[model samples]
Every structure is written in C-alpha cells, then in structure tokens.
Target: MNIFDRSKHIYLSPDFEEIIKDTIRFFNGTPVHSISIAERFHGTGVYAIYSIAKTGIYSKFHLVNRTAFHIPIYIGKAVPKGWRQARQGLSENTRSYELNNRIREHSRSINLGEGLDIGDFFCRFMILEGKEGDLIGTVEAALIRKYQPIWNTLIDGFGNHDPGKGRYEQAKSDWDVCHPGRSWADKCQGVPANQEVLLQSIENFMAGLNSEEDA
Candidate 1:
C-alpha cells in the first residue's frame, strides 16, 4: 500500500472542495521559482515543487520532461508557527515569512551542492490565508498522492532540519545519500543503500508506474 493511503477523510465543505480544485488548477499552470518571484511571495501556503537538469546531475532520477522543465519533485506546506510565527499585534507584512523562508531554505539546499543548480527549480503554489493546519495538510497530501514525488516517495529527508543536541545517532536519510552537503546531516549515520542503490530503486519504481499505466 502507499504510505499515505491510510489518511482518508469523507467530509468536505464547499469552500474546501473549491480550494482543492483550485490547487489542482494551479499546478497545471506554469511553474515559478523563488528567484524570479522573491518579492511576490510572502504568506503561508502549500507549494508544488519541481526540478530540472540540463546536464548529467539529475539524469538518474525518474523525471518527466516538459520541453526544458522536468517533473515535479516535491510538495510542501509552510505555516507561520514556532520560532517563525508572527507575534500578536504584528502587521500584515510580519505574518508572511513562513512560506518564503521555507522556499529560500530549499533554494539554499540546491545551490549548496556543486552539481545542482538553483536555476533549475520552480514551483506552483497557493497562498493559504486564514486557513487552518488541517486544510493546508489536506492540499499538500492530495498533491503528493497525485504526483508521487520522487523526493517525497523514494528518497526522503528533503524536508529535514538539523537534529540538535544528542540526536545524531540515527542513519542519514536517503535524500542525503543522493544529494549531500546539508551541514547538519554530516553527523548522522549513513543509510544502508548508497546513491547507486537508491537510483536503482527509483528506476524500479518508475518501471512499476509504466506497467500500471500500460495495463
């Protein structure tokens, strides 16, 4: 079974139903990236992330090519909370850091590695204003299920942060194996499968997808 199949819900309000349809429509539109839209994005939202490569760097992964662009690689949600949350009585401008910050962090990750280019990434997103966490999660989960993102499904840990203090004993994530150089990830134990093994697994998964589509 798919890892996310257990999360099932039957009821949906008309507003939320409309939001879901809107999110899907947004994904079908042209993708945008943080570099070009930096000033435009400043709010809590769910984003559909995509990646492309002009060279051999990402050629091993299972990605669909659209002219120069490649497949959607990940889906993420960013809410204002914890350290990044807007304090009470803050202005409207102050409440919009969550989504932009998360996207910047991802851009940093792509640029940190010499083999990858930040210019290759783009996203389709919706700014979720006055939306609760459950609704935001519902949209993100729906997109992940629809795309079956490579980073979200086979190679994990694209969303991980530094495990502070005494939490470095666990094995490193599959994502780190495939794309390294996140400084905090250096202290963790390595996954059993190396980059080549993970690549093979992606190949097998893509083959399964083709089989299902053909059948």
Candidate 2:
C-alpha cells in the first residue's frame, strides 16, 4: 500500500479538494492513484483533511495537515539540498545522518501532533525529473528538509507533480475561489482554482475518503 493508504481521517478544505481533483484528472493518463480525505476538521467555511496517495512510481506522496496535494506535484525535479549535496558525491551514510538529524530537530520543535508528515517517500526518495518526466529518486528519507539553504524548487503550493499541463494549470484559477494568497500549504504554492465549484469538488475527494472507509 502507499502512504495515503496508511493514513486515517485526512481532511481537506473545499478549495484544496478542487486542486487535488484537477491534478489527478490531469495526471490520470500517467496513472496516479491518491489517498482519500477522511475527517472534517473544525474550520470556518470549507476545510478538510484528506488521505491522498499515489504509489509504485519513483515518487510517493502522503501528507498530514498538507493543504496541497502530493505525489503528482512533488515527483518532478524537486530535490532538497542534502540530496543535491550527495549527487555532488557525498557518502550515502553521511547524507542520511545529516537528513535524519535535521528532521528530528524540526519534529522535536513542534508538538507530536503538529509536524510535516510529508511521508517516508519524501524522506527516502528525493523528487526528480526522469526521462519520462517527474519521478522519485532513491535518496535517503531525512535529507529532504534542506536546512535554510532550502533546495526544492518544486512548488509547495497546491499540487506537487502535475507536469505543468493546461488541464492541471486551470486549477490555479479554481483554487483562488476559496483560499487567497498567504493561505498556502506548508512549503506550498497553488495556482488559482474556483471555490464556487465546491459541491463537485467535495464529491471527488469523498470518493477517495470513502474508499478508505471501505478498505
């Protein structure tokens, strides 16, 4: 199973749901399957957490408190600093050590409940662009944080790995309908999407969420 499958009761605010749907629909030909959103959190207007996942590729995305959708947006060419350092030819063991310590420190700073559970996939394989397109590279898990130098160029906004397709690009407009600027996901950036389409968006996310319940 993928990381999204491992999570329970993920939530997504209504606008986030639209971005997730648009990203998936755009990338379906690439054949990505994601985790579903589970429970609704206490937020005004529309907000939720979702168990989104897509697995068996170079990249895997699992998230908690992540407003943006993962996997699809992250896979292509998004290397954090430590991995880049390794590519320049650092020892693998050294790379892993630095990464883990960084994450532990960050995780420690936050309460157990609040942290970037971006997932083992991110921790392990750094996101990269392969011959086919964006795929995960088998880097160690801990190196993704990149310290203050901040290596990743991939967007932290809405979707992680959409390949910049027009269909996916349309999500930019849609996302704006609900959350405006500064409401970004962790390390997040999302194109605009139409929040007015709330009903249909919720239905799509619910399909994933309900599937989790069935499983």
Candidate 3:
C-alpha cells in the first residue's frame, strides 16, 4: 500500500478549478463590441481590448485579429468601489458604472494617442454583478495569462490614471512613451523610455507569440 499526505501540497479543489474554467469560457463567449459603444452599458467585470490596426509596429496583432480576435492588446478589470474594503454591501447601491466608465476611459486614452484610432480597437467584456463581481480580478488575470496581452505583460501603464497633484515627479510609463498624448502624462517629471527599445521589446514579444503558435 502506498500512503500520501494530501495536506503537504497546496492546490485548488477540482470544483474550484472547474469554476475558473467555466468563468473563462463565459468570458470568451461574450459578444465582441466596439470600444466606442462601451459607454452605453454599466457594470463591473473583466474586459479584453483587441487591436486590428495595420500599424507597422503592431502588424502581428493586426494580422491575428484581422480575421479573428485571437489576440488581445490588453486585459483589465473594473471592480465595485469599496469592494476591496469589505464593504461590498454598500457598493451594491453605489451604481458607480465602473466597467462602462473604465472602457470609455480606455477609448479616450486611445483617441489621444498620436497614431491610434478608436475605430481600430474592439473589446469583449463580461459584466459580473453582485457576488460574481468578486471573480473580476481572477478572470482578468487568467485571461491575461492565457493571451499574454502586450499592454498587460510588456508595454505597461495603459491602465494608469492621473497621478494627481504631488506625484508629478514619477517617471512616464512605457505606454505613455510609446503612445504619448495624454496631457497629464506630460506633467510627469521623469524622462520617458526610449522609443527604439520599447519597439524592440514589442518585436521580441511578437516573436515569442509566433514561436508558440508554430509549436
């Protein structure tokens, strides 16, 4: 007879794993919509932004999403205000429109980009209200892991908000460097990253994605 102690290892129960898988499937099954239309809805949950632009730097993403949105440029979540403070009950009535506002905000950011267009970006979102809202972060993280979106993994800071008054001394984000047009980002006292280096990083990331597909 062989004896093994299950307590020695940490793992999610099969049921929990299945729940995650189901959530991912639910998210993927959601309708793909334009970022321009995001302001028409309200809720809190996870979303994926896809780019089908033919920009030279983003040609790989364009190619992948041209026929089908198999790649996401970014994945993110919007959670109810105060949910993090264990005051979820209060959040229920707040009607903050977190998800809608977040997606709209992304549209504004893209509109401000030097060479980006809102029409070239599309999104798929799942609005997990009430108890399901708790899964927002988990679903976003899982999708990001599965897709390795460039905005989430490589070119960071696409989700950043204004640093407010005293935080102007912070360095500009890589996203700001690559797509600079946000007025507030200009006030950041630190120098932006080198464009060439950021482009190289993007190329390397695309190469890895290609290698994975070939495998």
Candidate 4:
C-alpha cells in the first residue's frame, strides 16, 4: 500500500508535530515524478526526497516499492529569510529563493559522488504560506525525528555549506565520509567510516523501524 494511504489516520491531539505529519501526508498524495534541478520552486515550505531501490547504497534501505515514490529518505524545510524582518519594515525582501538552490546543491553533490546518481532521486514539496519565526523549523524537526533519515542523522552534512579556508582543517563530515564528492570536503582532514560500518548502521536503523511497526 502507498504510505500516503497509510497516513489517513488523523491525529486526535492538536500537537504541533501532528501538523508536520499532516503536511507531509498531504504531499504524499501527489503523483510521484522525478523533477529536474533546473526547475524552480517558490515560497516557504517543506520537502521530501525519494529514491529508487537500485540507486547506490540506497539499495540497502530496501524501501518497499508499493508506491509511485519510494520511501522518503530525507525531509527538510525552507523559510524566506526576511519574512520576519519584512513584517517589521526592516527590509523589503520577501523570497529567499534558497529552497531550490539547496535542493540543487544536493543534486550537484550526488552527481559528483561515486556510486550515486542524481537521477535516481526525486522530491515532493509543499508551500506553507504563513510564518515569521521558526514554524518551518518545527515542522522540519518533527519530520526528521519521525523518519530518522540516514542523511539527517547518521550521515550528516547534507545541509552543509563551504566552511571556507582555515576551516578545511576540520574533519570531513560523515556525509562526505560516505558519499565523498564535494570538492571542499576533500580538503578536510578526516578518516571516513568504512563501508561495512555505514551499511551496518543503515541495517540497524531499518531493523528498529521494522520492530516498531511489528509491535
């Protein structure tokens, strides 16, 4: 069954986290299709990344292929940087336009890496119209906490930016350790986790999820 279909059970409690789950559930109803990085997305919102089972180490995830889109591997939020400031009449800026840029950055990183194909990834996003503070952040945190995507947890740095000079001396991120393609990451001095460890981590995470579902 489609995961979206499974999400029809509405939460009776009015917790803020339920809003995040509900938003994701709404997008899960959209048709699953791959999008080009060149495509532009606007507004403040949350997004989810999907992958085919045949793609790179994601094959190990063994995401059940019952839906048009595979299981969500990552979830994120984007908020217009100046939305709050604009309200205070401090600045006129409205759109951060960083949402698509962030996704494209991920695509570029994936394309440059060995054994990973940017083409295997697809995404679904929903725009949240109103917010000044960390509303998007709350939703993002909720989704990540519920899903526990490996990119968000075990292999961090999917949201990383260039640390600039002097900082390159810092150890590489677990993301770089596993995927290894970002040019800046190469300069960072760090020992990456071996493939065996990486795979084991993924396996354990999946097993835990399965155990929870069974219980």
Q: List all candidate RMSDs to the true structure.
A: 6.7, 19.2, 3.9, 9.6
Instruction: Give per-residue CA lDDT, model 3, range 111-191, as digits (tens).
Output: 998768788999999999867877888888889989889999889999999999999999899999988999999999987
Residues 93-113 of candidate 4 have per-residue lDDT tens digits of: 545555676677667777876
**Residue by residue across 45-145, what tens digits does model 2's lDDT show?**
10112223343211122332134432222221233344445443334343223323333322232122121333321221111222311122322121232
- In model 1, the clashing pairs are none
Query: Clash number for every model?
Result: 0, 44, 0, 0
Which 10-residue window in model 3 sums to the lowest lDDT? 206-215
Of 2 and 3, which scores higher on lDDT?
3
If ranked by TM-score, best first, what sequence of candidates would result?
3, 4, 1, 2
lDDT of 1 by residue, 1-215 (tens): 55665447556567877878776776566456543356645677788676655454454332444353334778888875652444433465665677788877877877775456777677667677663444677788888887788889888988888888699887778877777788878799644457788877866765554322233
Q: Which residue pairs show collisions in model 3?
A: none
**Model 1's lDDT to the true fold?**
0.68
Task: Return the lDDT, model 4, position 198.
Answer: 75
Candidate 4 steric clashes: 0
TM-score of decoy 4: 0.74
**Runs off by more than 4 Å, candidate 1:** 1-19, 34-37, 60-63, 68-70, 82-93, 132-134, 190-192, 205-215
As for candidate 4, its clashing pairs are none
Error of 4 at 162 (Å): 1.0
